[model samples]
Target: MSSNKNKYCLFVVVIGFLTTNSAYAQNYKKLDSILKTANNEIYSNPDNVIKIGEKVVKQAENNVDYKIKGYKLISDGYSAKRNYEKSLEYLIKSSQLLNLSKDKLLKINIINKTGIQYHQLKVYDKAIQYLDQAEELIAEYPYKDSVHTELGKNYLVRGFIYKEKLSCAIAITYLDRGIVELMKVKDVANSSSKISIAVYNKGNCYLLMKNNKLALENFKKAATIAREINAKSLEAFALKGSAKVLFLEGNYKEALEALNKALSLSVGVNDLILNQEIYRGLAENYLALSQWSQFEIYQLKFLETQKLIKDTERTSVSESLGVKEAELKAKKIELSNKFYYLLLILILILILIVLFFYVLVKRKTNEIKIIKDKIYLLQNQKVKEL
Candidate 1:
C-alpha cells in the first residue's frame, strides 16, 4: 500500500537523520535522562515541575546558544500537570532562545513554538503573527519535510483555538484550508500519519459547527487513513467526533452506539479528558431522552474527570488562571445564575397577574349577588301590600 510505503520512507528519513547527525543522537540521550527525572518528579510532586523547569531555564540563561529543548520539556511537563504560569515562563525562555538560532531552520521551528506559547496565552493575534512569520520563513528556506508539517500544525492549532472559543464558522474554514495545504505536501508529509490526524481534527471542527454532512465525509476519510497507519488513538478521536455529530442530529440510537465504541477505545488509551467528554455527552443525550438513571450515572462519571489532572492553585488573580482559558469557569456559573433568577422573576409576575384577575372576578360576583337579593325582597313587599 502507498500508506505503508510512506511509513517506510519516513522511517528511513528519520533513521538517516539520526545516523548522519551523531550530535543530535548524543543530545537525545542527555535530554532523555533529564526528561525521565523531570517526569518522575512531576508525578510524585507537581510543585517540582515548576522548580525543575526554573532550574532548566537558569542553566540555559548564561549560555547564548543553550539547549532550548530542555526548557521546552519542562514547560510541557508543567503544562500537563496544570501549572500554567511556570509552563508559560519556560515557554517564553524557549522563545527567547530563538535569538541564538544561527540556523534558519531552527529559527523557524522556534518561531512555531513561540506561536504555540502565545496561543495558550490567549493572545491569538500574536500567535497568528508568529505563525505567519514562520510560514513565510519556511517557504524561504530548505529544510526537511518536517518544516511544512510544522506549518500544518500551526494552522491546525489556530483552528482548534477558534473552535474552542465557539467561533466554529471560522474554525471550519481554517481547518479545511489547512487540510488542503497539508495534502499538497502529503507525499513529502513525512510527518507520519500526524497529518491524517490533523485532517481528523478538521472534521472535528466541522462537527462543532453542526455540519454533519461535511463532518461525516472527513471523519470517514480520517478513520481509514488512521487504520492504514495503525494509529488507534486518532481513529478513536475521529469516532468520538462522529458520534457527537450523530447525537446533535437527533440520531440518538446511532450516536449511543458510536459513543460506546469511542469510549471503549479511548479507555484503553487512558485519555481521561476524552473519557470525561464522552461521559458528558452520554449524560446529555440520556437527559434529553428522559433516561434518568443513565443520566445520573454518566453525570457522575463526567465529574470524576476532575481527579485525573492536577488542580492549579488560585491565589493571585492572574496566577489563578489555571487553565489558560480566556474566560473563567466562575463567570459562566455566574451567568447561569443570573439567567435562572430572571426566569424566576418572570414566573412570579405571571402568578401575580393571574391572582389579580381572580380577585376582581370574585368582588364583582359578590356585588351582583347582594343587589339581586335586595331587589327580590323589595318585590315581595310590594306583592304583600297588593
Candidate 2:
C-alpha cells in the first residue's frame, strides 16, 4: 500500500511539473509569434510594426538578442517615413543592445545599419566611419556569407555621395567596384535589385564623362538584367538612361520610343519620381523636335508631379503616426488579456504544488499510523502467549 501510494505521489508530481512547463512554453510561444508577425509587417505596415515591436521590446526586457531585433524593426519603420532623426534614435538604441552580443555577424549588421542611417541623413563622413568599421570586421572574419552584399551597398552609396559632390572620377572608381561585387551576386534575390541600380549608376557616370559607347553598353546590360529580375523601377530607369544615350547619338526617333516605354512602365508602377523624370525627358524630346505645344504640356506635368509626390509623402508620414498610436491603445488591451491568462496559469501551478504536498503528507501520516498499529498488535500477541 505504501509503495503504491509513493508511485502515485511521484506521478502527480510529474504531471504538475509538465503542466507548469507547458504554461512557460505557451508564454514563450507568444513572444515568438509577436516577432514573426512584426517581421512580416515591417515593410508593409509600419503602424502594425510599432505595436508589435512594443510587445517584443516589453517581452524582451531580459533578452538582449530579442531587444536588438525589436529596436531595429522600430528603426526601420521610422526610416521608411524618412524621419531620419527618429530612425537614428532607435538604431542607436539597437546598437546599445547589440553591444551585449559577442556574435560577429550581429555586430557587423549593426555597423551596416548605422552607416546606412548616416547616409540617409547625408552625413557622409559619419557614414564612412561606420561603413569602414564594418569593412574592417569583415576583413577580420572573411567568411562567405560575409559582407559581400553589404559591402556592395556601401560602395554604391559612397559612389553616389561622391557623385553628388561632383568628384566624378572618384565616384566612377567606387561605382565600378560596387558593380563588380554586385554582379557576382546578381543571381541572389536580394542582391539582384542593387546590382541593377549599381549598373545604371555606373552607366550614368560614363554618360557624364561623354563616354557614350561604354555608357550605352552598361545601360543595355542593366536593362536586360532588370527585366530578367522583374525589377520594374530599375528597368524603367535603365530605359530612360538608354534613351538619353540615344538622344546624344542623334537618334531622336529611337530615343522617343524608349522614353515612351519607360514612361508607361513608371506610370503603371506609380513610381512618382520616375514619372517626373519621364515627364522631363518627354519635354526635352518635344523641345528638340520643335513641338512647342507638347513640350509645354509635359513641362507643366513634370512640375505638377513633383508637387504631388511631395504632398503624398507628407500625408503618408502623418497618417502612419496616427495609426501607430491607435494600434498601441489596442495592444494594451491585448496585453492585459495575456497577463490575465498568465496569472491564471500561475494560480493553477500554485494550487497543483499545494495539492501535491498535501497528498504526500497525508500518505506519510497514514503510513505512520499503520506502523503504530502493527507495534500495538505485536505487543498484545506476545503478552497473551506468555
Give TM-scores for every candidate, taking all chains together and pairing residue i with residue i. Answer: 0.56, 0.60
Can you give the lDDT of residue 211 in candidate 2?
94
Model 2, runs deviating above 4 Å:
1-96, 100-102, 142-145, 183-187, 267-272, 307-386
Q: Write the per-residue lDDT of candidate 2 for residues 55-90, one digit (tens) a residue.
A: 778887677877787788788667644555577678
What C-alpha lDDT does candidate 2 achieve relative to the native structure? 0.78
Candidate 2: residue 338 lDDT (0-100): 97
Worst 10 residues of 2 by lDDT: 37-46
Candidate 1 residue lDDT tens string, 259-309: 777776664445455677788888888887889999999999888774543
Question: Candidate 2 — number of clashing residue pairs?
Answer: 0
Against the true structure, what is every candidate's RMSD?
Answer: 25.7, 20.2
Angstrom error at residue 310, model 2? 7.4
* TM-score of candidate 1 relative to the true fold: 0.56
lDDT of each: 0.68, 0.78
